[model samples]
Target: MRPPNTPPARAAATATADDTEFRTLLDRLSDKATEDYYNPFTTFDWPATIPTDELWMSPELLSFHGTELMDELSPARLQALSRWESVNFYSLNVHGIRELLIEVTRRVHTPGFELPSEFFHHFIGEENDHMWFFATFCLKYAGKIYPDKSVKLPGAPRDPDIENFLVFARILIFEQVVDHYNVRMAADRRLHPTVRHLNHLHHQDESRHIAFGCRLVHLLWNRLLERDPDDVALRELRDYLGRYLTTSIESFYNPAVYRDAGLPDGFALRRRLLTHPARQAAHAKVLHKTTGFLNRIGVFDARH
Candidate 1:
């Protein structure tokens, strides 16, 4: 077995012919990130108070949407729910960005990652700015950012290539799910201007991030296949990623969000909503693009 710290042979060879297209894409993305940079601190005029009477998120994107739960709540209560849910959403971003940053920082400039290090610099900076603005919005307006409650599962031992693939794949899944919400909320005029602008700015940066992530994930997965041309490893990867996707979707339904909105039976409500057919359909809709991409790349079985 290779030493735990050693980078894979396939990964360390930086000038393989297969990498040519990826190199060109990386250059284009890095230049675009430089050209489109913005000061997140000054980009927004933070309002003294975001009105609580208005919706903070697009109603259709709400967890309770398309369910009987929607009709059960009065307008005032619904607005309260939207406010807290909005805070919860941004809180998730702060936590998710922190995790991805750590993972990316660890790999940047490490063996096998030399070519992408330049773009990694841009990615790391933008994501830090993202985490800052997200946390700022949460603390400035909501008084606190919700604590991350995601449970990390123990995994079987794996080689460096597998570990690296899992890290980037998880990041890609997280970004795609978030970009779904960002795209919708940014275009939603019904939301507060601060909320809309935050989403719009995030979506702009994430578009490039998502593009880079997709290419990198595909490259890594292909490298893994070349190193281990076996069905067992492929099956394991698919199963692990499938569970990660489910967990990602389930994080959106935080019981604390319901409790903060003054709803009773917060945990019970979360459970019921999660199992509801309408909510299931909504989950599938939100994850459609991400799942389709994975399927096309053969990371996921089409039958799933």
Candidate 2:
């Protein structure tokens, strides 16, 4: 565990004895990481064979799940869709982890991160291993990891405080969103063995990341509040989080998954699924815990 206030000076300002809330939480989190250390490379037994006839993701968790489209698909077709959907899910993990690596790597050596650097060291290594196995599954079974072509949002705030706020907030959002899937699929015995193992391994590591993120976000929100009391930065952050969460949920509806499933008009299906009220409800459910936590912490508001 990183000491209460590590070197590099700036970290002490935020995490020294003065900030008991953050220091205590970070200390607890660091201990948990150390005690729960895992080597992702050797954790799961990569199956000798992936079952083609079995479902890869729970039927209830599918993008078109609970919709008319789900009913229209034959059982075999649904099974096929699940296989591709699992690939899409893993592919998203790969891409998300890649972005996280870039963010954490740049910050680990920066001034404010000195205290968190120790945990970030473990975080980066675990995430890299995650990306490797996820991409391995995608490439082995699905032939390729799907590319993210969604248009990137612009106008990120230039203020360093707000920027820092956005960084951890976004990290929290991404982890919690994917964790909704990981927690569910990890426990569902009906899915393929490979899929279950993948989700289980990810869930174990992410439990630590999510705990660290929740505390870090709370601490940063406090700093953001003290540093920018006018609520100007808060409003910008709320807006970004709203859009970011929505986009994170919608990423599950990849057109490539549809195309690979032999479904017609992949783009059309993505459009329909994303716009459906049922799908919107499901998205809300997926985001319920995360959004609620953010709102409770005053980092997010529905009216913002």
Candidate 3:
């Protein structure tokens, strides 16, 4: 097992060798993205109406899944909840893609990023298409995209490497979590064809994006380890990332979604569902792959 504070032995190799490996991976991923590209606007045959009776998302992926709250809802209310939750999920994608685009655009072609700038072009383009499709789905089906209510933490002075790592790490976390849903929904026969198709397309794109993100995060994190070996910094990074993972999970339990679904005391329900043992287990399952990757890369302690 890798130590929590130390970069993986492979990641700690010579910077020159790491750079070469990363560039090679970038080239491969870029090529894959190009080959896999599809016009989001024309890819889907948007239906005139999605039946309200059918689920828009996989039931197991819902925020309240496995909880008493889920069992309490009538079949009609359950379907209604799934509909709003599905819209909320896409709305999150729109906001998350916008944020990542700004961050990636800020660094693309800028100093210290000359090598990856080319791949960033493909990344930015794909993310924009993702945002467009997600927003369109919400508007056409739900009549409106849910407003983003996430609060941005104030920026503090930090080393350039730390800033870069945090930016990309957040992006990686978001993509990984979203991809978890995308994969399940895309394959779930219970969902509408349009829902499955949209998720299928997003999942295909996210596979490449997640691959690129993992390599870049490994590179950036290793750079941080080399420059700052202090245990304090390692602990702080671990704690911050743990909190971020929790926040990402919490976002799925939106009060707005609960209220839209006709559930009373939306805030209270969110709190209750988040703490339920069954839901907690579900959260762990959802985050299993991502947390494992972070732990392996030494961004999170095994105990985390």
Candidate 4:
């Protein structure tokens, strides 16, 4: 076996003498960023007015944890369920993109990262415009944008060091988790035309976001390993990541959704979905992607 100091040949093949050459990893990453940069600002045509609709969600992809409850609703109520879910989903994206871009701005400026910083600058620009469209749609059609929640997950407070690596990891994790559902909506040709269009656009952008995010987190983790090799620290990071997944999936069945559905008790239903087996499985799909990425980065219990 080769010594630990020795580079794997495939990696060595493309590495520079100064730093290990990563073959296509950096190039592909930069390319994706470039494409996002070029059209990110102009990717979608903003409709002057959003059409009125009861459901903004694609039914095929609804988590279905408590969807049978839908059978109890009148036609109008059922339509409201769809609208609430779709608007809630996109509104969260708008909020997330705003916060994440701010983080991206700070990271793009760290020492010795000049070469790679350009992509992040462009990435943030795209996200800024993306936040605009999503927020605009909600304002124009929904009459009000969804507000951010004060919910806190179980974890250490975000310190600067953690924010540098951990926040990006958190953002990356939650976004892919979103794709676990949004992908279904994007492909469901049966959804309302406007809903379909919204999902289709967001899905396209998020595809690139997840790609860069996975690679970026892995890159950040490697840097962390060089500084501290503690297994506990690594595990804590993974646990924090797991908490976000749990909390985020739970956010799907919000009080607003429950109240809009005309359910008398909102918090109780939210609790049930968080605990229900079927819903748990759907939630698991989101966590699994993040866990897998952590495993690939040598940060998790990989025995599986």
Candidate 5:
């Protein structure tokens, strides 16, 4: 058997004698991930049934959880909404992780990028598993996965350094944001057993991914600083990330989910709930940890 501390042969071979501390950190983290890895396929007891009448997501984590709008919902309506909201959350994971998978695979095996590339292999494998289970649950329960809208706001920086940094930064942001859901829902006993188990499984893998992402951002930022050092572009990237977070937060307030849940004037209801002061406060609270970490790492000067 391989020693507990030994990273796989591929990863071990990539770490040279003069590797930087950053590379060493990546190596250690990758080793730990391998040692602690779980097979996403068989990790959970895939329930033959999931009870929709019971809460799928915690009441507090729902988009309208603390708002007046939620108070208006009957117990039955609230339970129904929770089911769809859980679908939306999982659907978002499927699409968001797909994007990151593309970005990571594109760069994983490129020449002259061997150190972190070793870890990218594991990252790609884990993400594929995540997409599979998330999509599977959504399809089995909701009948379809949410489709992603292909849209990017204009004025994005064209610099390769800025572009590359944005990819990893955005991945970190998405993971951290969804992690807010995973951490809470996983521990809440009020949710269905299958739902709680899925959350627990995701949280287990993401803890490693989040650790790697934070360090990756710092490393990428150091590279961008040396090569570009353009404050204007940096700020633009930060603002872009802020926009990404806002849109991600708003996705939970989906009009379709509201409409299907039998709510009237779905669009109008979405607008009200999204603009409510309480919901606005909740958005900030949800993102606080991620934004705070990014700010500390010099990715942004302020919270998103």
Candidate 6:
């Protein structure tokens, strides 16, 4: 990690860290890239095209607080929301995946990481295909993908090689974080077949990604420890990840989801659900998964 409040003369910001997070994240990236490299081409059993006539996604899955706002909607509005949620969720995935893919591309070829260097080529290929499938759905059905939100964070700008790992970690964390919805949608029979398949496929790939991330975090964290016992980098990483946790919880409150459902009160409801103790407990599930492994390896502090 970059020294906190370091003077500019010491080094340029985002210069590579010599720690193990850099090496570990890259290897995981390479592994995922390798696993997902032919993702759509090999994995998806597409036969011509799935019909889009019925409800694409379940409305309940899109609710801001797991409460029904759609029950209050006029039949026409209710139907529109069902259609919109399918598109909305898919669009969000496209946007989120695009950000993750770009991060993967930027840091994949950064110098000095030999193992990652080998796999970086495959990482880009996998993401490119993932993007293609997502974009294809949006174009074929909804006309275009929704634009990405403008989110900016100011922490250490990662060294290109190191950046790949941190960025990918964030991506993995984000996925597991929001997986409550994905899992719900994947199983909910009320959703259209196409919607179920989309979540099912993404969830399948995400399982591998999550596994890769868990192992990588240990390898990198251990490496960081060997480099420095009382390293400030670990603190920075914890703090950064905590912030990521907040964002993951907040993403579920789509004001758009509310307005379409005819409940302008959706934003307020979102605030409550997102901050609710029960909801927060739900968020803890993934943190538990990641932290348990980190603890078992003796690399993590039990305190959040």
Query: In terms of lDDT, which candidate is strongest?
Result: 1
lDDT of each: 0.88, 0.82, 0.87, 0.65, 0.80, 0.59
Query: How far is each candidate from the true structure, as Cα RMSD in Å?
Result: 2.9, 3.7, 5.2, 5.3, 6.4, 6.6
Tell me the tens digit of each residue's lDDT in model 4 across 1-304.
3346764432322222224343255566667766644453465665675443445676644544345554566767666667666677767878788778877776675553444565676567667767777787677767777787737666663544455577778788767877776777777766656556666666776787787677666666666665564767666777776666667776677777667656668787677666777676666665787777777777666763
Better of 4 and 6 by TM-score: 4
The segments of candidate 5 whose C-alpha lies over 4 angstroms from its true place after superposition are 1-19
Candidate 3 Cα misplacement greater than 4 A, ranges: 1-18, 154-157
In model 4, residue pairs whose N, Cα or C atoms come closer than 3 Å (at least 3 residues apart or on different chains), thus clashing, are 15-21, 55-82, 55-83, 56-82, 56-83
Candidate 1 colliding pairs: none
* Candidate 4 Cα deviation (angstroms), residue 144: 1.2
lDDT of 6 by residue, 156-181 (tens): 43643234346656776766754545
**Candidate 6 C-alpha error for residue 13, in Å:** 22
Question: Using alpha carbons, what is the TM-score of model 1?
Answer: 0.95
As for TM-score, the candidate ahead, 3 or 5, is 3
Q: Tens-digit lDDT track for model 5 on 1-304? A: 3356765433333433235876777778788878978887778677776876788888898878778788989999999889888898998899999999998888776642566788888889988999999999998878888777435656668876677778888898889989999999989989887888888878888888898888777766766775557677777887788788888788888777887788889789888888888888999988887888887877766534
Q: Candidate 4: lDDT of 128? A: 78
How well does model 5 score by local distance difference test?
0.80
TM-score sort, best first? 1, 3, 2, 5, 4, 6
Going through the candidates in order, what is the number of backbone clashes in each? 0, 0, 0, 5, 0, 0
Worst 10 residues of 2 by lDDT: 8-17
lDDT winner, 1 or 3 = 1
Clashing pairs in 5: none
Per-residue lDDT of model 2, residues 1-304, tens digit only: 3455564245434453366666677677778778877777677677766877889899999998989999999989999999999888888889889988998898886766656777898889889999999998988877788997555767678777778778888888889888889999999999877888888888988988998888778777776676545667566667777888878887888888898899999989999999999998998899888988888888766653
- All candidates' TM-scores? 0.95, 0.91, 0.92, 0.81, 0.89, 0.69
lDDT of 1 by residue, 1-304 (tens): 4446655563354433348898899989999998999999889899999999999988898999999999999998899999999999999999999999999999888777878888999999999999999999999999999999997855633878888888998998899999999999999989988999999999999999999999988888887777765787777777888888888988889999999999999999999999999999999999898899888998886797
